[model samples]
Target: MFIKDYISKDYPAFNASDSIEVANEVAKEFGYSHVFIKKKGFYLGALSQQFLEESAEGTLATLEHHYEKFALLDDGNILDSIKLFHTFNSNVVPIINKLEKYQGYLSCDDVFCEFAKYPLFSENGALLIVQINNRSYSMTDVCRIVESNNGKIYGCYISAFIEDDVQITLKISSENLSSIDETFERYGYNVVLKYYDDEKEELLKDRFGFFQKYMEF
Candidate 1:
């Protein structure tokens, strides 16, 4: 989804001339570690709790010297926001318009929620990882095999690739994937990994845990 759809104005922003005390108050009130600083309508940067605590007696303008100018445009996608989250290790990211006007911020929760809604994660399905030669791979045959076995593909993604081989991860709607597995084997596709509901649940739990820990910065 587009970043603007999930942009939130709930988080507070401070004027460049505002005090670190004001920023700290707003952050504490909202349970945020950082707050955005703007000059007029344009975004200047962000001030973090650690920065504010270390340099308490300063204006937002002074804190601006230490702020990281991380932001995404209004038309950017969720992937773009995710990159920013990882790069800056921030819980929230500022969104700006074409004119560089601060629109709002996208929170970690919002991005995580959006990610959870993706078919690969949200759908009740089985995951199959297949290894295949890059030059010989054909998605048409893969779909045919699954469909022929009365299985429905909810989603699929390419995981990793080497020079000659690639790994493809498929999310299938059927719980019983024996026939599909046999079909792939019959067609000479090597099944590298498989995950059913129980295994997928554990895997996702660990993944989300890592995601939460990653966002804590």
Candidate 2:
């Protein structure tokens, strides 16, 4: 799942001498929003389509163009690459080698797909949304509550509301909704949402009849 596995060798890259027009054409042909601009084993920056359309030059090297901070990495694990990709909001990131030379670009989708295989919990799990006292957001309290109810805590997402209330979204491996709901509610943990809660099937069917009339050939 590392960058080495997902790095795309086929991605179209441009050289310093390449015309801005050529870069735009390559981007259009490849259906890419941005094109990598490189010089002899080194990545300079990227050329964006939006910048090309707005400027008079409409070229990669024009003064009117700008690029976001390039995400760089020498060698890293899959976890490290995923963290960098999310932080930079980049689709293609440059991977550097030990020699500080450009190796290739990692496609964001490929990297994410690999990381998703290892999730916080297994697919057969339920999520509980609990509202606790504003001061109680510690892991100890969360573990105590889940263990008391014979539920195994798979993962937890802790967040604070705008009104200073603490909310803990705990993922448990228990599918017994009635028992889990009653146990948490007894402990004053307001259950706002449940991930395993069954949806109202008729809701989608009812809307489909109304939506079908708007469809035209």
Candidate 1 per-residue lDDT, tens place, 1-217, comes to 8988988887767898888887887887876667898888888888777668777576888765687888899898978877777787778888999998999988888878888888878888788999889988888888888888888898887888978998888999865599899988887889999877777778999999999999998
> Where does candidate 1 stray beyond 4 Å?
162-164, 186-188, 198-217
Best by lDDT: 1
Model 1 residue 45 distance off true place after TM-score fit, in angstroms: 1.6
Q: Rate the local accuracy (lDDT) of all candidates.
A: 0.84, 0.66
Q: Top TM-score: which candidate number? A: 1
Model 2 misplacement above 4 A: 1-5, 53-59, 63-65, 74-90, 97-100, 119-122, 152-154, 159-166, 185-188, 197-217
Question: Each model's TM-score, in the order given?
Answer: 0.79, 0.67
lDDT for 129 in candidate 2 is: 81
In candidate 2, residue 208 scores what lDDT? 82
Model 2: what TM-score? 0.67
Give per-residue lDDT, candidate 2, residue 211. Answer: 83
